[model samples]
Target: MFSTGQLIFALFFILAFTVVLIVTYRKDKTIHKKNYKGFGWVGLGFTVFVIILFLIKHMLNK
Candidate 1:
């Protein structure tokens, strides 16, 4: 039930926000590559840990 003006403003805001986010990520890409090399491993480890916990809980419930 949004008015035409509100819809237009929302579209413009989303476009502007997306452009800013992309530009900021591009600018920071090099810094992130150098400083966060092991980040993927940490994420993977956490995911595995969560899966193990779920499996253990399911086994104990049975």
Candidate 2:
């Protein structure tokens, strides 16, 4: 289970990423945001997705 602080940090992390992307796109023309997905993060994202779904199902069952 994730604590409130953990959730808040994750929210802030996403928000900071969005802000950074917007700021970089506006300030620079050729930042080159995306080329290809790196293996680690892609795997991590999928793992996180699965974990979230499992957590949801477990909570619902409870």
Candidate 3:
């Protein structure tokens, strides 16, 4: 079992880490929007490819 001090430290650490992470993401939000534009289509294509592969495997196994 964790000591009380250890649990308190973890709680504060998590809160500080989350705050820092949100601030960092907000600072870079505009840069990310420009850089990662059209990224969703690539993800969609990859997902479709995986689904096609799974379907082919299922059909062949039948």
Candidate 4:
């Protein structure tokens, strides 16, 4: 059986990965679309929500 610490650690690992992805994506400015700004921000918000939900589930399962 997995331990609580393991679940928490995994959650943190995923969160770190998400942060890295978001930062990398934001820094990428090669695209010239004057209409994607809103979509981009909404996508980032979705990523954060998913991370938070995953963390909550991990904690609750313990």
Q: Tens-digit lDDT track for model 4 on 9-51?
A: 9999999999999888777654635546588788999999999
lDDT of 4 at 11: 97
- Deviation (Å) of 41 in candidate 2: 27
| TM-score of candidate 3 on Cα atoms, chains taken together | 0.65
Q: What ordering of candidates by TM-score runs from best to worst?
A: 1, 3, 4, 2
Those runs of model 3 whose alpha carbons end farther than 4 Å from true positions after fitting are 43-62
Better of 1 and 4 by TM-score: 1
Model 1's lDDT to the true fold? 1.00
- The true-versus-predicted C-alpha distance at residue 59 of model 2, in Å, is 37
Report the lDDT tens digits of candidate 1 across residue range 1-62: 99999999999999999999999999999999999999999999999999999999999999
Best by TM-score: 1
**Candidate 3 residues 1-62, lDDT tens each?**
99999999999999999999999999999998999999899999999999999999999999
Candidate 2: Cα lDDT at 38: 76
The local distance difference test score of each candidate is 1.00, 0.86, 0.99, 0.87
| Model 4: residues with Cα > 4 Å off, grouped in runs | 31-62
Instruction: Provide the clashing-pair count of each candidate structure.
Output: 0, 0, 0, 0
What lDDT does model 3 reach?
0.99
User: Which candidate has the highest lDDT of all?
Assistant: 1
